[model samples]
Target: MRRWPRIAAWCVAALVLAGAALGSATVYFGWYDVSATGPHTVPVYALLDVASTRSVKLRSADIDVPDLDSPDRIRRGDALYRAQCAQCHGGPGQAPEPYALGLNPAPPPLVTSARERPAAEVFWIIRHGIKMTGMPAWQYRMTDEQIWDVVGYMRVLPTLSPQQYRDGAPSGGPASSLASASTSPSSSATATPPGDMRVGDMRVGDAKAGRAALQQYLCVTCHAIPGVPGARHYVGPSLDGMADRSRIAGVVPNSPDYMQRWLMDPQGIKPGTAMPALGLREQDARDIAAFLQTLSNFE
Candidate 1:
């Protein structure tokens, strides 16, 4: 009986080792196709689905869902959804843009997703996007309140007809609403003065906005930016003490103008450099430079 038990243990260990070896070989030999054109195998798809679903469920369990039934909130969410999300995850009776079709794990039509997913799960997914999916983490661009508003809209999306979706939100899109809300008298009362900071002769570079822009532009994916939450990737040099650094990318003087220029067109300044020209807007470059200036020997 003891021998039988020992034999069973040996058999289990052998199976585990065999599985590991097969997996390693598959990876090392590149036998598995990763092309987005093809769909995943049934088992692989099932595994990923379970993993993602469970992850969302586990993480969203403790979320404090606010009352989301207000008409104004839903309208605001509708505008935001149209502006930000509709292109990829189409609205009711709306087709996603052609590009969304090419994505490997096709962006789910939110009409069905909204009906099936819990509010908390949807909110969490929007806030911290799914990895390897085209879905982006909106936390970098949108505030928590804005994300909640989207969630509120999603809760009511299943009930709206295609015509209703078109006629529901404001006409000028979310930009006007977002801009008005940000520049409202109440908000402007506490706004940072134009002269409070400057980057590259631009007085409009807000450090707070710059910080958010860094994440929005996915700079954290490559560089370990101070005060940004992301993987501590070493693909680019850390910007921990950028304020004190004497050179921009070890080429130009680390002045405001040079810094902004470097950010705007890194490849143009230093041809063949690993740094890419991110097509940053002038304001975005200035804001990023201002934010970088705040990273002073605090590593």
Candidate 2:
């Protein structure tokens, strides 16, 4: 045992020395490429990505998310994103400006990637900012509500075309212009009453499709949804009695409209939640809602 301990200590010491020597040599010789034009090797980029995601997840896990999806909130977020984020991250219509393109490890396009992350993690990254990267801490510069508003807008960013995005902006022309553009099912079809068999207000969509939607969107990775076999993960709260619950995410009332909104942008319903916006279509959210409602009496 004594010899084993000594051997382990020597091995650890050797590893530390080797790491130190390698780091010093890299610094002294400038062997690692620091140029923006020269991308990090695939393995290096993967490692950094994993580290950043893990760190964000661990640090932001405790933040209490509030509702992030509302008409006003999304509008506000859209304005802010256009004004500030579009310069670097770009959007549907806007390409990243030259300044952003020159940045080392260039900022990823938010419209494509933001929905995949938890709202809390995105909030933390926005508020605290990442070191070494160009992202600055916004907590000092912007209010919590504003950061959340930006997050809310990001939820819908993937869905918006450049024209829709520009129109939604206060300076981008009249909001009425959107009427000509919106081809969504809810907007295109004749308005149906609350309990219509095709698309009810409270109980809409096919349950079987909802289950499939849950699986397709990887909801089981976090929630232990009833009826979905093998959906027992504990990252978020269980969905066993989601239908009976009066409130969704402790805020929005449990109704089909609210649930659809929740599914579209959970952070908008409750900011800083582990639930990321999955960017599902209106009909898809309705399908998921129908399935979730059936879980009220689940065993």
Candidate 3:
């Protein structure tokens, strides 16, 4: 019995070592096909599917599900889905765009996913997205309320016929509400005056818009940004007390133009810096710079 136990232990150790060696060799020698044109082998696909499914289930286990039967909420989700999701995932009447078709492990139709997965799992997937897949993390671009709306809409997606989908949510619905809400200033949050700050000759950079833009661009992921709700990570230095700093990235003078330039192309000014060039649009760079400038201190 003692001898058998020892043999079993040795066998397990050998197997672990062999698996490690195989993984290392595969990575180093480029033995795995990474091409999107090629589909994953049966075992590989099965393993990945199981892993992703389990991860979503575990993470979403504790999520509090809201009442998704509200007509307003469903309508909002319908509009949002048509605008943001339909192109990639398709809908009752629609096919995914040509580009979405080219993606490896192609984006699944939400109609099927809605029927199969729980609402919490679907919500988590939409908010956080999956790795090594084309699904984007919508948390960056959407609020929690918005994500929930999408989930609500998805629940009803399977029930809609092609004609009903085409007809869309009734007139004077979520679309109009969304438009009005966007134009109207928030009663709670203080509004930044339009063109309160300028970058170069252009009168731009609304602080309120800038703050939202910061969240949209995933800046909160790596840095501890004030006012933006996200993980308290410090992969990059905190943006607090940015206004007190005289230099941008310890290189250029901390002026609006220089700050915008840095936001647009971090690598261009400082070669080999860990900060990636996020391919920010000119207006987005200006907006980000404006938001950073507002960070006076850690308080």
RMSD of each: 17.3, 14.6, 18.4
In order of lDDT, best first, we have 1, 3, 2
> What is the overall TM-score of model 3 with all chains considered together?
0.54
Q: Which residue pairs in model 1 clash with each other?
A: none
The global Cα lDDT (0 to 1) of model 3 is 0.70
Tell how far residue 250 is off in model 2, in angstroms.
46
Q: After superposition, which runs of candidate 2 have C-alpha atoms over 4 Å from their true positions?
A: 1-19, 172-299
For each candidate in turn, the TM-score is 0.56, 0.53, 0.54
- Worst 10-residue lDDT window for candidate 1 reads 174-183
| Candidate 1 structure quality by residue, lDDT tens digits, 1-299 | 78999999999999999999999999999998887644566567657878988999999999999989999998889878888997776664344554664565656656556567788899999999999878899999999999999999888887876445545646664323322433354332133334443435556677887876665454654576755653322345788889999998789999877888887556446644545434466776778888888889855
Best candidate according to TM-score = 1
Q: How far is candidate 2 from the true structure (C-alpha RMSD, Å)?
A: 14.6
TM-score of 2: 0.53
Model 3 segments more than 4 A misplaced:
1-8, 169-299
Residue-wise C-alpha lDDT for candidate 3, range 1-299, written one tens digit per residue: 78999999999999999999999999999998887655566567668878998999999999999999899999899889988997766665344554665566656566656767899998999999999987889999999999999999988987876445655745654333322333355410122224433436555777776776664454654566665543322346787888789998899999878888777556456644445434455676777788777888645
